[model samples]
Target: MMLPWALDVARERDIPLAVFWIQPATVLATYYHYFHGYGELIASHAADPAYEVTLPGLSRPLRIRDFPSFLVDTTGGEVGKVVNAVFCELFEFMDEQRRNVKVLVNTFDELEPAALAAMREHLDVFAVGPVVGSSAEARIHLFNHAGADKTRYMEWLGAQPERSVVYVSFGSIWTYSKQQMEEIADGLRRCGRPYLLVVRKDGRQEDVSRCLEDVVQERKGMVVEWCDQPEVLSHPSVGCFVTHCGWNSTLEAMALGVAVVAAPSMFDQPTNAMLIEEEWAAGVRGERNGEGIFSGPELARCVELVMGDGARAVEVRKKVESRKGMARDAMAPGGPAERNLRSFVMEVQSSDEARRKDTNTISPPP
Candidate 1:
């Protein structure tokens, strides 16, 4: 059976492996570089009051804000540790297209057309993406009777009135200061809306929730460690989503017809927020702390703007159609995604005999 040697067997059989990408094309474009000016670019942003960066090849101005948080670590980030510990072997397992294999990125093209175009010049990079959105149909009925009970979050939303609830979550990984969290709590209350907060399970809760105790104790609010988001957003009760503007969450909200209050933290998040507010007309940007929501009244105003029947509802709904169209086109049969699949098959077919003769490698590490 060669059960344990499945990867080797596949390589021997000339099966193509797919190395799906989730992070932005910009983050990855650096991998294929000998001189990306990465260090100088970061220094320029941090040093300049204008907060802009210009790299060797990019055409547009870079915001210190747009760079990924890992670079800011400057202190030899976990990337090095992770690279040595994990990616070293992982990258080795890949039979790179350099001109042969196919690269499947989960980002829709419109979101990063510039970087995507740059990447296409290098390899067979297909934009069949926002892979997260491929499951939209399943998310639409998120809280509908079936999975609601298991999530433990469905019942709470039913108790609120239509468009009266604001759901707050900063994604699976993001944090903020105690002072900033308190300010946002006050802002939400001032905005005069009922809210459900999904605070992180980390130690910051007690400090961050300093101002939330009164709201939590009262029936006007609820707080939990986690939530069933699609279920929560679909609830007739949730009026606005105060989110980190994650690509998946933003797209999922669109799929389920929920409005968003964008509060992007880092990485491509701000870019997503920029698109949501400036381009997509889907959400209003929230007051931001360096890597989290700035606590205060501005945060409150964002909640109110997107709540029930505001100026944004009509425009927001209409623009989502464009995004949906682009997203669907990527995943359609014989579209970019499908084309990548076909190319991958052909590559494997042509290389099977060569790989079978070489037994130096196998599967990626778990």
Candidate 2:
């Protein structure tokens, strides 16, 4: 949405511009295809949730439900209309500058190699992430939780056995309906494991309080409005993360070697969930019922499948551990991300120097 204004300002000021894509490289590729050749196919089947669309460089065909929520949103309301328009314009802007622009993606090479490669065919795309580091103090928390005791949760996690707890959080933005909250509460209970759930105390505080009262009273779980997610995921006692599959959360869980039970809600989350369950083989995606609600049994089954004593669970853990090592290597000093970033800086500097020399050489046109 801000791309047009940014580009205009950069061009007017004769400055260099490099787009930093905060989403995964896979999503960039998806959007690239959406605007390039697959838009019509997706638009034709926008109303059909079961319809699948195949794009280049992806191993599997994605259903309409798997596409970014903005594209698949049937709501013709103002919000949807504005979202659709902004994305269309953003892609058009990218297409116009594809020859000169390079995008820095917030993802790592080992994470989405194919997606990165696919985008590189059109533009210079660099994998400069799992941008987060492993330092607890270096973490960035956007929201301010006033007077919240952090040690209480840390102490609770410390007391639990290694890999014995299910950590549930649905990112910071999305709010759940009362029914959905109850279902998730029931699912956590059915999983028969110690759990820690983070339900933001936005508008849904009363509902969340009501739904989680029993579980909280039983001491089987704890519900807080917010916490340090990376810190929690890094804890030894957290075995499985029941997540919304947001990219940051997904990357954090993978980096910390925690297996996931993906419960995606919107946007790039469904795609991230698919990659987590199918591509990476580090987790399982939960099944949603007809009304698009993830049922309690489905959640429990996914949690157990990833966190249980079964062979699949063991295999998932091993895969996640392997990826965790890869993520660490990618973010380490002088690693791929750092090297690519350095190269980009050098390229921009060289370009700017050449431009300055050209300007100096030009004679007065009076």
Candidate 3:
């Protein structure tokens, strides 16, 4: 969304504006989630693993138990508040949302053909993804400031053995209570996998005293404020991601052939986690307590499930690997995503041109 706005601003300013997009058709399938009754039915289905219900638009029974945990939040709570705020903000940005809104998502039409088919109606969306594969190269020039250890992350991974280290990072805005932090730390320790944890420098009460140091010492580990994630995930030494299921992270993990353990925090994260864990068969979902508390043991189980060389891990790893080809093809020169992007550009320009032609502030007929 910001990308589109920034491009539009550049266009309005008559400055250089280049827009690239990936993923159009896949996202529309999600709008089906926005329809009334869909969320609840999905939730009802999720509450009972054997529960079966019809998807709003798609004519199929989405097993209740397999539904993403966001169904719990659909009943109206903090999650519902967030969803409502998004709709409110959508109203506020109704004009802006439409104004040259060139869109991209981290998915492929092959992986989400049904959703993508639904999205073709929008005309401005492009699905050019698994961007993380191209991102390490993309971030090469992002923060070349002095004293920045750009390659330090890479070097760290180089030191680890193959598929031995697990990389952990809660995306940009997840805050944990002190106990939750220790819970995560404990899980990492119990899992006994070599790991790295990136804790953002936010005011999220992090009292890691409870066995955090012990856990790190027991297994060779690294904890930092932040690290070049795409680089880390891309490394062969990195086997799995215990993630918040952010769209970028999901795509990154999938692109790098790193299995995901979805500990989704909020907003679209749960939905994204669902896509990864349920729809894509690329990850295991963490256990959420009745109050939405993600149990450390469940987190650990998901991690081991993804990292282990078991049947599930093999299945998920192959699924993730398969998505890479789809994503790569989507981003190619004249692929669907690229074609959609060109069309999006034309639509935005056309809409702008039409608005300019209709800008006359005529007074009402006297």
lDDT of 1: 0.62
Model 2 has an lDDT value of 0.84
Q: What is the lDDT of residue 250 in candidate 2?
A: 91
Clash count for each candidate, listed in order shown: 7, 0, 13
Sort by TM-score, top down from the best: 2, 3, 1
Lowest lDDT sum, 10 consecutive residues, model 2, at: 93-102
Where is model 3 more than 4 Å wrong at Cα? 1-53, 56-106, 121-124, 130-137, 140-153, 203-206, 209-211, 350-366
lDDT of 2 by residue, 198-257 (tens): 877773667666777766887887888788888899999999998889988999888889
Which candidate leads in TM-score? 2
Q: Write the per-residue lDDT of candidate 3 for residues 310-342, one digit (tens) a residue.
A: 899889888888876676677788886678667
**Per-prediction TM-score:** 0.69, 0.95, 0.74
lDDT of each: 0.62, 0.84, 0.64
Supply the TM-score for candidate 2. Answer: 0.95
